[model samples]
Target: MSRWRTALVTGASSGIGREIARQAAARGVDVVAVARREDELRTLAREVRDTWGRTVEVLPADLLTAGGLAAVEARLADPDRPVDLLVNNAGFGSLGWFHELPIDREDRQIRLNVLAVTRLASAALAAMVPRGRGGVLNVSSVSGFQPMPTNAVYGASKAFVTSLSQALHEEVRGAGVHVTALCPGFTRTEFQAVAGSDVRSLPPWVWMTSAAVARAGLDAVTRNRAVCVPGAGYRAVATVVDLAPRDVVRRLTALATRASLPAPEAGR
Candidate 1:
């Protein structure tokens, strides 16, 4: 059984967010599913209700907008309908040289990944700290562990998430609230297509299923772990990155990332 009675999961229309919602419901927790895609959210709601007999609330809202953010924040803060868990999983990324990517998109990425997560977490903690019970699971990425040359903004955003989660974990541990950062590496999700990341060159073993990542994250948060790196290979990479000198890690990451990209098309 889940420690939470109700969970509010962002980015719930697909991928890791969708899996988290399904798994949480299966574990006996009601869910509030948030995403920009209403149709997909409704579909997931039907599936969850049918399979697990759990109440699934489909909340279609773009986190990038103020109104959407307010709606979700209000739900988390509702005294009568309290949320026992907050899954900050709604985010996206872009893969390209920092200068080449559209500035507007990068700004939106930071807003969703960093600003939205921060706002939601703050709202959840405000409620949970008073009640002395609850959990916040922030979905981050292994890219945050090192300098991602082609994926700089996304990496920085996740680093903020991981840092914030760890700090909050210590802050609320005594108050009975658990805060955890779920840092996943290369996972099989719509993320690749959306980010324009061509991972065809990577070995099969490097990718993880969304189900496995979701399961690991849920279990870790329930156990009050400050950080959870889902796969053993990723854990090894994170460990090495942590111990390695900053310059060495940055140089190696740049080289590896550049090698993965196709050569630039004929110059303008």
Candidate 2:
């Protein structure tokens, strides 16, 4: 197994982020796990240390905050010792009518999903470019390929991620910095729980394991693939969505969004 040496992963407390950290550690990569939940981050750090016997450092920061993002930026800019890999996976979705959603929640989603991703990717590149060897894997979604009615903001953020990943890959090709965007479809993760959606209600085929998705994503990064949509089923769906008429796709997505919305509380 090739060691990553030093790797930093945002949103490392759980789900795909957690799986990425564990897999990297298992292969002898020293991991810095970043997330808002200190307790969960610490717990996962311990698990990595015990399970993989690799060094695991936890950095608890809400990437949406200026102070937190600044702190992360400082860590990534350290030239004396640079990280060899970066995994941008800190993001979430709001499953509801767009107008009914709270303004602050919408802002948080964009801040963590888009702004933080762009900033961190830049910082990682600043360090990696000088050293001339590293990888950046941005975790996007199949939603990025189409209009998502209920997950509108989230989907837009991921589309930004995918676009940025492709652009960066071309720009940094000769500089030894490989960039990849991982477009996954409904992986088994705490993402739905955080988004307040019932994952179990979705069809079994729609759910992929976080480990499996992470493996595919990391492989793409190592191989320097510009974009990766892991499963055959997901790739097929993405192809159809890519080719479908825009207006028709939007209407169907809006109907599905309506079905996913929660009923108003009894007192309200």
Candidate 3:
């Protein structure tokens, strides 16, 4: 029998997800890190094993495919694999106005960010409910609070995550299973590169480190917080949005998005 608690973190190959896995392992938790990159996942597993002397399992799955989700389901259902923590953090971003973006990419983004989180949450909760103790961390974003002109679909998907986490937190309140929505703003990660965020365009003060974000999320789960806003700056922004008029928030976010990730150049 594994003595350490078992945590399953999706998108564990990099960014906030990878940091979460490392943090959990350091705290004496065995981890099952899932990602599409098999090589990176294996490397992370080895590193975690070496540093923490904890059991590390690498399960490479796309999370955007039915086959990938099925693999996750199988592992969750396996009697021997009892997940004490579940981190739903696999997602990506595509920049541009919604109409101008490729429809296929938008479809993939929705499938990965929204559908995958819902399916994985169901699987994790199904097992955890029976055991009467567990934690689920949904990686949402500040973008979820308002319309994002450059990342509309991505924002919508994160909104779904935030909503789902809150509902689940209430539903399982007394069941010993806590659910937390980790709403992080700009974290220093490959996400900006993928989203094509122009460094010169945004304020430098908005960014948070991956390790700090991971720590805040883990702490939230342990304390059973329904929503975990990692950075003070982000929390303040969220507060402002909540207090401001809806239209005002909408316009501001739209303008910010437009400025951050501009459309591709006209000619190659």
Candidate 4:
């Protein structure tokens, strides 16, 4: 059983975030599911309630705006509705050369992927530390461990998440709070479609389900583990990237990423 009682999950409408919410509710935790899609969030809340018999409150807001982000911060900062688990799972990527893609698009990606993660994590920790119990899970990617040529900005954002999560994990270990970065490789999600990449082009062996990734993240954070790359293959790959020659890793990553990856579709 998880020590957490209530959780606030960004991007809880679908994919890995939704899975995490379900898993948390299964362990008897109340959930506040945040996402831009109001309908999807409502549906998920209903499913969680019906399936796990746990309460799920849906909050629809875009983290890109100051108002939307502020509302979430206030909720986390509120002592009355204290959230013991925080999952920063809301993020998207653009697949293209850094210079070729619209600079504004990359900036939005950073704002949501990096800035939002930083601010929300801060809010969660500020409250969690005082209470002396809580956990923060930041959903990152395997690309954080290596350079991704086609998706440079997205990779950079994940790197920030991975680095920050590891540092924060150590910083708050004695404070009775856990911070974990969940670095998952390719999974069966709408992420690829939205990013304008075809999932079928990638090797089947590299794919894992969102449910599997969510389970790994929840387990790791509960155990106070700092970093978790879910799949066996990806774990081995991450280990090699950390130990291997930087030049070799760079060349290999660029080559692999470029082969299966296409530039993001126009206006995507």
Clashes of each: 0, 0, 0, 0
> For candidate 1, lDDT tens digit of each residue in 1-268?
6799999999999999999999999999999999999999999999999999999998899999999999999999999999999999999999887777899999999999999999999999999999999999999999888878889999999999999999999999789999999999989989999998778889999999999999999999999999999999899999999999999999999888888776555452
Q: Would you give me the overall lDDT of model 4?
A: 0.92
Off by over 4 Å in 3: 1-4, 261-268
TM-score for each candidate, following the candidate numbering: 0.97, 0.93, 0.94, 0.96
Compared with the true structure, what per-residue lDDT tens digits does model 3 show for residues 1-268? 3222888999999999999999999999999989999999999988988898987798999888889999997787677868888999988988776777899999999998899999999998998988898889999998888877778899899889999999999999999898999999989889978766566656789789999999999999899999999988889889998899999988887676566654556631
What is the per-residue lDDT of model 4 for residues 1-268, given as tens digits with 9 covering 90 to 100? 6789999999998899999999999999999999999999999888988888999988898999999999999999999999999999999998876768889989999999999999999999999999999999999999899778988999999999999999999999799999999999988888988787766656678789999999999999999889999989889989999999999999998787767655555654
Relative to the true structure, how large is the alpha-carbon lDDT of every model?
A: 0.95, 0.88, 0.88, 0.92
Top-scoring candidate (lDDT): 1
Better of 2 and 4 by lDDT: 4
True-structure RMSD for candidate 4: 2.7
Name the best candidate (by TM-score). Answer: 1
Model 3's alpha-carbon lDDT is 0.88
Better of 1 and 4 by lDDT: 1
Which residue pairs clash in candidate 4? Answer: none
Q: Residue 173 of candidate 2: its Cα lDDT? A: 92
For model 2, the run of ten residues with the poorest summed lDDT: 259-268
**lDDT of candidate 1 vs native?**
0.95
Candidate 3 lDDT at 133 equals 89
